[model samples]
Structure formats: C-alpha cells, structure tokens
Target: MAQARENAVSEAPYYQGLAKSMMFTIALVSLAPLLGYALLSGYQYTTAYKEKVEAHLRELVLKHDQSVDSYLREKVAEVQVLGEVVGGDRLKAEAEITSLHNALVRSHGSDFVDLGIVNAAGVQVAYAGPYPLQGADYSNAEWFQAVKRRRVFVSDVIFGLRGVPHFIIALLVDVGGEQWVLKATLDFMAINDLVEDIRIGETGLAFITNRAAQFQTTPRRDMTGEVKLLHNILARGGEDSILGRGRAAITVVDDPVTGREVLFVTSPLKDGEWFMVYQQDTADAFAALYRIRNVGVAVLLLGTVCILAMAFLLSRRMARKVEVADQEKDMMNDQVVEAGKLASVGELAAGIAHEINNPVAIMVEEAGWVQDLLEEGLQKDDNEREVQRALTQIRSQGARCREITHKLLSFARKIDPTVERMCVNDLIREMAQFCEQRAKYANVRIETSLEDGVPQVEASQSEMQQVLLNLINNAIDAMDPGGGELDIMSRAEGGDVFISISDTGCGIPKANLQRIFDPFFTTKPVGKGTGLGLSIIYGIINKMGGDISVKSVVNKGTAFTIRLPASKEGMRCAAGNGAAGEQPPADGGRSEETGG
Candidate 1:
C-alpha cells in the first residue's frame, strides 16, 4: 500500500504544489488573530495614556493651588499679628507705624509692596513703603468695607490708587475696643512667580483666575489684567467652572487663547475665589504613548514577516518530502511489476517442462520396445509386425516431442509488439480454446457474448491474447468447488471497446481488492496459483493505453472490465503523441509476464 501511494505521487508532479498551498493556507489562518491583537493593543495603549495624562494634570493643579494659597495665607497671618501688637488709635503716629511696616516688609521675603493703617471711619491714618498713600481716603473704598465685614480678605489682582498691580491682604482688629484695619499690598511679582513654578509637559502653560474668570496671573504677563478674561473657556466648561467651583478635577478642552486641544486641570486656591489652571497640549502629553505604539507596530510587523518566512520554508520542506515520496513509490511499483513478470515466467517454464517430459518419456519407452523386438528375432517373420509397430510408435513419440519443444520455443520468444487493427472477439476465442478442458474438468460453464462488427483495437495480438488468457484462467480458478459460470462479453461504446470477464464464484474480499494486481498476492492455496496473473494482465492493458477495473463481492462474484480505444487510429495517435507516460512506443513493446 505504501509503495502504491509512493508511485502515484511520483506519477503526478502537482501533488507537491498542492501540499505547499495547504501549508500557506494554514499560516494565514494562524496569523489573522495575532495581527488583530497587535492593532487593538496599540489603540488601547494610546487611549489609556491620554487618560493618564489627564489624571496627572489633576494632581498637578492641586499642588500648584496649594503653593499659591500658602503664600497668601502667610501674608495675611503676618498682618493679623501686627494688628494685635499695635493699638488702633496709636497707629495715627506715622514714625512708629512706618518703622513697624519696614520691619514687617523686611521679614516677609520680597513680596510686601506696602502697608497702610486705617481707622474705622475708612481713613488711611498712616502708610509706609513704595507707595505714598499715607493720606489716601479709605472711607468710600471697597477693601475698607470688605475688611470690616470679613475681618480678613485676600483680594484678587487689582490696581491700587498708586496705579500698580498689587492685590491686598487686609486684617480687621478690635484694638482697645476701637475698630481698625491693617491693609497690606502684595507684589504681583510674587503671584506671577508662584503660578510659573508649576512645570508641566511641553507646550504646557499655567495661569490663575479670580472668581470672575479673569486672569490673575497670566502666562503672558502683558495680559494679566481684566482684559485677559477667559470668556469662552470658563463659559463652555460646565456649570462648576462657570460658578468658580472649588473641587480639583481635570478636563479636556480646546484652549481659547491658543486654540489647541489640551488637558485642563482646575483647582481652587485657599481663598475659594481663586483658581490655579494648568493646561498641557494633548499632542505633547501623549508623546510617550506614540512611541509605544510605534514600537508595538514594528514588533508586530517583524513577527508577521518571521511567521510568513517560516511558513514558506516549511512549505518548501513539505514539497520536497512529497517529491521524495513519489520517487520512492515509483521505484517500489517498478520492482513489484518486475517481480510479477519473473514469477509468471517461472510458472510457464514448469508447464513447458511437463509437456516436454511426457513426449520424451513416451519416445524412450517406444525405442526400448523396438530394441527388444530386434533382439528377439531378426529373421523371425512373426516378430516383424511387432517390430514395425514399435518403430511407428517411436516415430510418433519423436514427432510429439518436436511439437512440444516448438510450442515452448514460441512461448519463450521475446518479440516487439506489432500495432495493428484486430477484432477482439477472435483473440478471445483463440485464447479460450487453451483453457476449455481445464474449465470442463472443474465443472465450470464458459459463456461468450462477442458483439458483431465490434470496432477494432490498436494492440499487439500476442500481448492481447496473453492478457485474455490470464483473466480467463483466474476466473475459472475462482470457482474452487465447481458448478460456476464464467461469462466473457465484448461491446463497443463511446469510441472504445469494453471486454468484461465475470465469474459466479468465491469472490475477492473487499480488503484485498486494491491489492489484487500486486505481485505475489493471491487468495489461492499454496502451490495452487501464482499471484502474478492479474499483475501481468494489468501491465499489458496499461501499456496498450487502456484502463482496467474490477468489481467484486465476497462469496458471490467478481468482474473485471477492460476498456480499450475502439478505433485503432485513436490509440495509435495517442501512442505517437507519447500520451502514456513511460510506456512503450506506438509500434510495439512486450508485456513482461514470466514465471519462476
């Protein structure tokens, strides 16, 4: 079975290509999911990174707000302490108040712009430092009223009467039961420095806003006044932002000033009316994510290429394996076919030996009888008839021996096939004549249905006759217990002639059907039959550019059908064209059937 499979592969060159195609298909199927995963993961990573940047901005805004608030609270606390130490009415003394303001300003790091002492009636009784506002009226001022109501106030950036951008920190004190306010102006430089200290990603900017959504400390110091109101950003940002809500949170928005998509984090300062706004461009923030995506794509492409390369290499290896398998099969088939031919030759040799031995034995006995008569009487008249009979018997036996040797020589002669148009019925009749007595002895009935005017086939008569003879013998032998029918039929159809030999006998088993034409495979008992009969027959039909097939059922019957090209020219043309691979030429060749 393995050899037969190998031979089929050897005969068909396209099988290896088929194997390669299959491997390629499998490789593609395996790669589909992996490719999808790589693409999906890259997308997901970028999305997550965007979210992460927003989250980080949320943290940064809170920290920045804390720093600003800490500075403002410290300034407010210092003023509150001064109000407690100095009495309200006594602060009307300008030298004592001016010295105290100088000490406080010196202690407060460079943020203190100026200081003023105010009476309950909204009058600045004393003032010190950079601004000359000692006599400045606070009676109708907003800070004077706010300080009296709130006790302490950290105002947003504003220009004082001195025409400078300095926000105020005011503390209301009850000194000796007389209401007084210590009002200090904080330098805008300190607020600007505080907002600028928040460092974010590339293209990031930080700014502070009052409760009115007006920029307090703008990145562009030139736009730091009321003109830098964030009209669109605070308006479009939800109710919480519009209302100056205090919760620290992050949002994604398009910057109104820069018109770039950015991550915006809003955190309220300690005063509750101030906010620290941190904005980072989305493109800059997700830069690391882009690199990760690129690396993933590169690795994915590399893996896909490697997979395809391996698939190609493996497919080539598989194709080579198929090719090798085919070669081995052809060799094995050739070996089996040759073996069958040799075995058949050996069987034929034995049959001829038996034929020759019989005639030779008869001649020897007859010669002995003549010798005895000659010894008995040369002159006796009575022995003449007996001597003459012995001589005649010897002559007849010698002629029989010569005839048997001639038959043996004719059968042994290796001759090339002669391509000719011949009636298949005639060939069948002649071959059947040799096996008739054997069938009769076995109680087997021979039947023939030779169609008249059947198209002639292009074949070698001698080889065709041998093929028919082998099939007939096998059919007869299959009916081991006798009383079976053997039917031989010939017909013409579809530009071909079909000859079928069928037997009603013990049939071939299903398991053995495929192997029937294999060398030395037989169901017959030992020494009863050589398995080469069907093998030789198959080889002959195949060489003639014909096909043979068998149908059988166990214990019922078996039929073999042989199909040959109906017109001689058809087969002859096919042969001439070399259509039958590795077979003989159109003119002639022998079907090598021999016995051992």
Candidate 2:
C-alpha cells in the first residue's frame, strides 16, 4: 500500500507565510496612528513657536516706538519753548537770539548740533553755532514747506549745511501775523542705539522703515541713511488689504537685504509713518521646531520597531502551534494506515490457515493408521522397524504443520483473547527456547534473570508469548554480522510485573527514538524489515492495559521494557473473570511470527 511519510517536529513553509502576513498587518495597525500624531503635533508646535516670536517682537517694537516718540517730543518741545520765550521779533535782534542759541547748545550739546531761524519765505533770518550763513535761502526746501503747512514737522535724515546725516524737528511760530520756523538738527545716534540693543538671536536684526518704503534707521552701518527704495513687507497678498493694516505680523520669506530665508516680523509705529522690522534667520527661529520633529521621528521609528518585534514573536508562537498540530495529524494518519494493513493481513492469514488445516489433519490420521497396520500385520524385525520409524516421522511433521496453522489462526480477528493470570517469567523462558537455535547459529549468548517472587500478570497468554518472541527475534537480528548477548529480565514491583529485553547490538538513534513505534518506520535494510513488529507489539500491550518504553545507546545496546498489572485482585476486577491459572492449553500453539 502507498503511504504518506509523517513529520512530527519540523517547521513548515505555510506557517512562516502566515506569520509574515500577520506581522505586516500589525505593523500597519500600530504605525499609522503614530505617524499621524507625530505630524500633527509637530505642525502645531512650530506654529505656536512662530506665534510666540511674533508676540515678543511686537512688544519690543512697540517699546522702541514709544521711546522714539518721547525723544522726538522732548526735542520738539525744547524747540517750541525756545521759539516762544525768545520771540521771532526778538530773533531779529541778532545779539539776543545768538545769546539764546548759545545757552541752548550749552544745555543740550549732544542733541542741538545747530539752531536756525527761518522766515516765511524759507530764508534763514538768523543762525547760531557752526554755520557762517546769516541769511541762507530756505525757500522751496522740503522742511520749510512742511513747517509752513503743518506748523510742526520731523524731516527724514538728510545732509544739509552740516554735510552729516541728521534729521530736523521744525516748529512754526507766528508773531504779529508773521510766520517764522525754528528748526533743530538731531543725529540718529540715539535711535540707532535703541535698535541695536533689541536682542533676538545670533543672526537677528532690527531696522526702521518709513511709509514711503524708505529706510529711516539703516539696517547696516554702510547703508546708513541710504536705503530708500523697497517693497512693503506686509502687503504681500494684496496692496490694499494688508498694507500697514496689521499692527504686528510675522512671516517667513527670503530677506531682501541678506537674500536668505528669514523669519521677519513687522511692528508698525503708532504714527503709521514708520515701522520697525525684526529679522531672524529661519534656521535659528525654528530650531526648536526641528528638534521636536526629530524627536517625533525617533519615537515613531522606535514604536514601529517594538511593534514589529512583538508581531514577530507572536507569529512565531502561532507557527509553532500550527507545526505541532500538523505533526499530530500526520501521526493519526499513519495509525490509520497501519490499522488497515493489520486488518488485511489478519484476514489473509486466517484464510490460509483454514485452507491448510484439513489436509494436515488428514495426513496425521493416515500416518497413524499405517503405523498401526504395520505393527499388526508385519512379523519380526526386518522392514517393519524402518516402516514404523518412517510413519512416526510423518506424524511428527504433520503435528508441526497443525501447530503452524493454529498460530496463523490466532492472528485472525475472529479469535478473541482469553485473559488469564500467567507467570511472566515462565512465558519469557518458554519464548527464549524458540530463539536459542538462532542465537547459537550466530554465536550469540542468551542470558536471563527471573526474579523468584515475580507475580503473574493477567493477560492473553498467546499474545504475551508473541510479544516476547517478537522482542527476542528483533534483539537477535540487531546483532547482525556479529555475536552479542540477549538479556531477558523479569521482576515484580508496585503490584506490577516488569519485563526488560535488552541486546548488545547497534542501537537506535536518539533522533528516531519516538518514531520507532510508528508503522513502517524502520532503520533496517530493505526486504529485511516489514517495520510492523514493534507497532503490533505496542498495540497488543496497550490492549492488555500495559505500558512499554525503550532506551538505547549508539553502537552499544538497546533495551525495551514492558509493564503489566500483577495483582490478582486488580486483574480479576479488570478482566471480570476468575481465570488465574499456572498452565496454558496443551495445544501449545506457535506464535504469529513478526520481523523487527
């Protein structure tokens, strides 16, 4: 019969495939949410950081704007006090106006570089300190025009008679219906100090620009009072919507002066004519953001690794379970195949036994009848003695044939076991006699140790005999090509009878120890083993409520031990019969032969 090979302890490919699939699923499930959370959190944190910077920049710009307003107010108020106290008509008296200008210069040396009194026609009527012009033309000048119209004006930085960059705070005074302008030149040193002191980062910058897109406070010392033409920073989207609209706003864009990516925050002065711009390198401003993003990435990667590790371990465990289940299923299939073979063999043996039984019986009767007739008809010695001896040989051979037929019948399913209490040691000794000739032929020794007090076991007498005979035959065969000792041992312990059959032969390997009981699994050469000897013995012992185990060492020896209940009380209860006896039937049927 064709049979499939059984595997009990190997990993299968399908199991690994399933584990891989499970790991993928787990990784996706775990990593998706982690990535999303990282992205969202990073974005929100960066946005908050930018907003905080914008708020701080606004506060700084507003404080600087207030300081600038106070400084200009103080200078302009001084000019007003001078114009009012020393009237414009008094300023026509050169001596008196010159005395007042000298006193002002002494009081405010850093702020009042020079003072000039100009008439409505823009001509300097009187001047003091530094300039030789007593009547310099002031008509058509931008400051003169602004003063005439607005009565007060703060001009952009310019280089006039002084030939140095400075601004003029002019006050318009009307005395006796004539307008005269008092103008004072103020340098931008104070404003520059304030802008420079506003600390941001290593690459941070601060500068002021006017409404006309002209730089009021120069961003760099080389570009002082020279930066004029520039685009409005706040009105990027639309000219009308965002221009000078926001009190303070922050943006990330390329800097016009540095031509590098920067974070620029604009805080328009309350006057609306000028604005303070704060610039920080984008890398510096958002460095915290980059750190946060890096942390998020690290956390996500770590979580993914942990999840994948868990998935791998869980999948491996599941794969092991699948492997074990497959091995069990294969073992079951092997058992089924073995059972079918046993059934078929039993039926064939029964049929053959029945066919040969009648002819063997007839031969035995005929041989006896000839021996009796020869003894009654023949006289004296002569041919009668030879005839009697021949008849006796025929009867003996016929009886041996009958015994063989009975042995085959015993293997048939139709024959039920008759459980009886029988001495295990006696059975072992009786079975060994059959193997003694074979041992002698091979020059092997048979040694036995039967404990004197070993109890009898309740079992099928014929089956027990067959079990011992099979074990002994296998032990003999294992020592092939050489002679070895076969050791048979019997003892009673714990109300159980134990029989150990051992041989000094090439032993079974450790790897195949468990598989030795499996049907058709044998290490013997082809045609030398049917591989069913041990399997059949296992089944028979289990049916009789006994246990069997084996131990072996390579190139040294192998041993098999069987355990059977030896108590008469337990046996009587187990078999439901009172068949404990010291002897078996007189037929002494031969055992069904099996190979190892």
Candidate 3:
C-alpha cells in the first residue's frame, strides 16, 4: 500500500510545484514581516523594561534605609544625654541612679533590658536585671573601653553581660579626678522587630546581615531560632570578580537552601561592611509578562494569516511588470553605447602617439640615473642604495608605460563599458602634463588657468581621460615651430562648467568649422590626422550633457568652448576630503549631451 502511494505521488509534477510555491509564499508574506517587527521592537524594549524594574526596586530599598538611619540616630542622642548627667555632682549620687532606674521601668522601658553603674575602679557597682550582674568585670568590653576615651560611647552591635543578647551604650563621669560609668542596654529583639515590620511584595523578601555575613534578622521562619549565615558569593570567588571581600552585586541563580530561582539585589549597610538584600522569586517576577506575551502572540499569528493571502497576489503582479520594463531599458542602453564608439579616430591617433613616446622617455631617464651614479665614484654602500632606488624607479616608470599602451590600444580598436567619475580640473591637469612637453617639440607655448573647486562629473575615468588628452594634442599640432600660444582654461559659469581650449594656430575656415565634429572630418595632411578627434570629443561631451562650439578669425586664434552641466554634487563622498556639502557615490553614471 505504501509503495503504491509513493508511485502515485511521483507521477504528479504540477502538484509538487504548486505545493512548493504555496509554502514559499506563506513563508515570505507571513513569516518575514512578523519576525522583523517583533525583533526590532524587542531590542528597543529590553533597555526600557530593565530600567523600569530597577527603579521600582530601588524605591523600596531606599525607604528602609531612611528608617534605619532615623532609628539609630535617636538612640545615639539618648546615650549622649546620659554622659552629661553622670558628670554632674548632684546626679552621681546613689539616690539619683535608683530614681532613674525606677522611672524607666514604670514607663514600659523593659525592652531596655539592662542598666548598670560602675565605680571609679571600673567595676560594675550597681545592676538592674533579673540576675544581679553587680561587681561584674565590664572594663574589657568595647563600650567600657571606648567611654574611657571620650566620656560617652555608643557601641556597635555586641553580646551583652550574662550572655543575653543586648547592645550597650555607655557614658563616663570624672568626679575629683576619678572616673565612673553609666550604661544602658537595648535587647536585640527590638531591632529584630524593625526588620519584621518591613512590608515587601508577595514574592520579595528583605533581610539584614552583619559585617561578618551573619544575619542579624531574617524573614525565614525555619531559621528564626538560629542566626542565619549567608555567603558572600563574590568574596568566595576571589579571582573572577573585581568586587573584593564583602561588596555585593545582583545575583540571579537557584537558592541553595530552597532550590528555587531567586533574583537578588543588595544595598550597602553598616558602613558598607554589611549588605541589605531584597530577593524576588523568579517564577513570580515574570508571571505577568509571560501571560501578556502568550496572548499577544496568538493574536499576532491570526492576523498574519489574513495578510499573507492578500500579499501573494500583489507581489506576483508587481514583479511581472518590473521584469518587462527592466529588459526594455537594458536594450536601449546597449544601442547608445555602440553609437559613442564609432564617432572618432582623432582620439585613436593621439593615443597611439603618446603610447610610442612613453617607453622612449622611460629608457632615457633610467640611463641618465645610471650614468649619474657611476660618475659619482660609486662607494660600495652608497652605490648599493642608489642601485636599489634606481630599480624601484625603473619598475614604476615601466608600469606607467604599460598603462599608456593599454589606453592607446583601447582607443585604437577596443570598445569597453567604462564607468567612473572624472573631475573637470584634474582631467585638464593630467592631459596638460602628458602633452605639454610635446608642445615644447613644436615650440608652442601652452598656458593653463584652471578654476578651483571644479566639480567631478560622472563618466568613464579612462574614456574621458582619452577625450581630454586628444583635445590637448590636437591644439599643440595647430601651433607653429617659432612660437604660437595655446591657452586652456577650465572654470564654471553658474550651473555650467566650461573648458576653453584656444590656440593661436591658423584659424579654422568658416566651412571647415561646421564639419569639425562630423565623423572622420579632419584638415591635417593625409596619415597625420585621423579626422576623429573633434568628432569623438563632440560625442563624449554630448553624452556627458555638454556642448562644444568654435569661434575663429582668419589669421588669428581658434577657441573651442566646451560647456558641461555641473556634477550632481561638488566632490565625491568616497574621497578622503568629503565634508557636509560633498557629493555621494553614483551607483550608475548618468548620461550627458553632445553638440556640433
């Protein structure tokens, strides 16, 4: 039965494709947007949610801190007042001490469990507690020793006389140069009540621990009978944490005793030797958020199913229209490219000439460097360094020659799809350098005044380079051996950038000027001019949204003014010097115009 089912499924091709397409459509239309929206919003909410939780927790802890400070200060003031009383001669009598004890007991100060008096010998002389702690030796206790230093002392938490849990506050008196002590004690149970009165959340617990990690009070009912010992996790790690000894950090882990996940936060207490902890049960902390998330996801999924049905039909229709239009645009662009290549041979002739001279110049310079090194008496160390430098220069110069040859061959017969941005001023500078020395051979003086901040217009970098070089070479050819001036200036006039190449050569005749940009038009003797320079220049400038015009007079100079539109932006962004007003990258170069 299974073999028959498999064979039946294999026989159907269209069903498989339809199934695949449906799955694909559902995945993209439903899954993509839902995931994208959730992910983007989740990232933004993480920081905000954490801050909200932390602020609420801090408020609960701060209130306790304020209460603790207030309670402690009141007790300190009580101890201070007693110190002054003992130093007074009238208050130091036995009758005064007995009256004070009786007044305290009548007022329900039984929680202040102990009251004691010490004689000048630093021994307890009178005591008021269930067990007579009279004559007890308390001189060694911290409160007793501290009072000797300042006549008044409030000791930090400590075990009291008779080994009952009490903290002592003591005062010293000096009568006739002899010292005495008056001490009061508060049961630790009073402090424990303060800890119990703190009302925290249902899942949250608060507790206090001493400097020794010994819990002074805990909310744990099981641990009520004994002092709870808490571990400082970071103090134990020693190596992993920067928090030394007793310092605390928020801890998220399973509780060792209860086996439940706890989110614990700590605040400094007891001058930072102790930590006040607020622990929240992890399960309870996230219960509300989990409920909200589940409901949101269910609704989100149902709405997405409806959206996918509509999106599938819309995407299919739009995609088909775009595919057809793109194909037609591609064909038109191909025809425009072919038309540009067939326009000129003047560029070809100039490129071939430059290519031939490049190698000869390199050889001449290399030979000169070698001759100079030999004539200087070539010391071995200096000779070796000079030879190395010469080799480097030789390699670099050969590379330049190869590049020029490549450009010349490309100009001669090759047609390539070139794409680049050409700077108006930089292109003129490069062409002038390449052809100016050739002008020296003809005794023609070529002058240049290029404007600053010339814009970089889009075109093929190499193709536009050929166009400029060809124009400069043609101008040099028109000059005389005795001396004819060539002035080339590139500047922007409003929205247009103009390159004017004016030469004091035999001026163009009226009829010749009209035919200069026509394909294959030339005035030079046969084999000297390919008649393609002006035509190629015209096509290139036209494709670049520019126009070329000539003005000449008989026996005077001829000026060719080529005007092109300013670049989309003044400077390209990829260049290191791009500032706020700079141009951004052009993914595809734009078309320009040509003129006769």
Instruction: Report the number of the highest-lDDT candidate.
Output: 1
For residue 532, model 2's alpha carbon misses the true position, in angstroms, by 18
Q: Which scores better on TM-score, 1 or 3?
A: 1
lDDT of 1 at 564: 90
**lDDT (C-alpha) at residue 234 in model 1:** 47
| Model 2 C-alpha lDDT per residue in residues 1-596, reported as the tens digit of each score | 11122222133567778788877887778778887887788778878987786677777767776787777778888888888887777776667767877887778766676777888788888777676878989797788888888898888777776577778888998756888888777767667777878766677777776666566676754433224313446444124335644555666776556666877666665355666777677877667766777887887788888888998898788777777787686567556535544543553454455546655766677677666767777675455775676677677767667655553454443223456666676567655654565577666788877776677677766577657767887788788779799899887788888899999988999999999988778787796566777887887788678899999998899999999878565322222112112222334332322210
State every prediction's TM-score relative to the real structure. Answer: 0.65, 0.55, 0.43
Candidate 2 RMSD to the correct structure? 15.5
Q: List, residue by residue over 61-154, the lDDT tens digit for candidate 1.
A: 7777777788787777778877777767666678877888788777776677777878878788888877678777888777777878899987
Q: Among these predicted structures, which one has the highest TM-score?
A: 1
For candidate 2, the per-residue lDDT at 391 reads 71
lDDT of 3 by residue, 383-405 (tens): 85886787778787777666555
Worst 10 residues of 3 by lDDT: 587-596
lDDT of 2 at 66: 74
> Model 2: runs farther than 4 Å from truth?
1-16, 93-109, 131-134, 220-230, 234-244, 256-259, 302-596
